[model samples]
Target: MLSTKVAADTTPSTRNYDDNVAVDTKKKVDRARGNITQRRCLIDNIWNAHVVDYAHVYEADGKKDGLISKLERSWNVKSGTLNSNTRRNIFRLSAKLHRLFDEEKWLLLPETKIVDQYYEHYREAGYADEFPVIKDLSFNYTLVAHPDMRQVAIHRRVEGVDINTPGAFKTFIYPFDTFPVIVSHVHPCFVICNSGQKLKDYDKIVAFRKGDTDQRKKRIARIQSFSKRLDGW
Candidate 1:
């Protein structure tokens, strides 16, 4: 899971993107539309939109590291959202939205309060046990700072873990792309957690429909091509 906290800064400068950059990014998107997924398109838009700075915090040899190292190491998913692909997508979308909002400076102080209330409600409802780490889960409110200084982006990585394997540490959260912009008040543009978790074995039921190895390879190739095109933009 991911969240962004936006605060006012004393800096007077603002970042802007060139019109040509957006035009070129759209061209790349159009070229890849025949072969890529909507998710990939969303990623492309986020990447070319602005300059983003990222920071990661995770456990290394039993020690915490990154901007959020002091926070708890364990994370819990809602009872049913544990499927590898589903979880991965949630992480990706959350990071993407964070970057998009940052780029536009459409961040509201109330949004941070809403995120805080969410966790408080979860704990008061006796859902802490659902995520074992919640008992010790404490957020460093001081970590929330002006985006210009440290554009906060966090992902909890488990060292030596294979992301493809179920229950692996890396599977807890995935890294995502971002862009930069100034901070300003805006109404909430998106909401998280509307999607429900799976109650059954997601992999066993969905794997068959995903296609064969050759098809998978082609999809990967297309994504790589799209990424390369964006690099040029």
Candidate 2:
């Protein structure tokens, strides 16, 4: 469905506290705690409600456009902000991920592959104040459904050209959030899929829980394993 043979194979995919003393100390604290609890519930309600809606849409129509629209709406992402073709490409990507989900072909991308080491280098060079620190940058996953080189070799034998060659395939990395309820944790993760169909798609590039710490470690391990084999190490 991705038009590109290789892409057809790959792609898919806080708290606080305080204490104090005062006149209405107990009452105020309780009220404040109540407000905080209510806010948390409200936030979860909004997010989970959309998750349910996404599942419903995917089930009812089995279409990615509907799901993508819901995701965009939840984030206040205006479809108008992107050109028609860019939007279409995103829709296609969402569709491809869903298909990969069905096929159980989602590949976990390792952070080492995309980690911006230079980001830290720059920060250490007295640029820390110049940029916002995004601690979650390392938590993002860049899942891809890429075929192995061996598979590509076979493909080359048949197609007479190696799709894996540089520039032969166009990779699209999307900062996709909310992958329905199936992907437990619902944390933000990147999705890398190629649609060799288009090379000019300007739609520029681009989760978990368990307190998010343990989840991240597990993902990193899995991705590292995949990366090893991918690199033929």
lDDT of each: 0.25, 0.25
Q: Candidate 2 on 16-128: residue-level lDDT in tens?
A: 11111122322332243212222111111221211211110011112333433433433344542311112012211132233443343333333442334422433364222
In candidate 1, stretches whose alpha carbon ends up further than 4 angstroms from where it belongs are 1-117, 122-127, 130-233
**TM-score of each model, in listed order:** 0.20, 0.21
The residue-level lDDT of candidate 1 at 151 comes to: 47
Which 10-residue window in model 2 sums to the lowest lDDT? 1-10
Q: Tens-digit lDDT track for model 1 on 45-130?
A: 22222432220111012111221121121133333222111111111123444444343221211123434444453436532233
lDDT score, candidate 2: 0.25
Candidate 1: pairs in clash: 80-198
Error of 2 at 215 (Å): 5.1
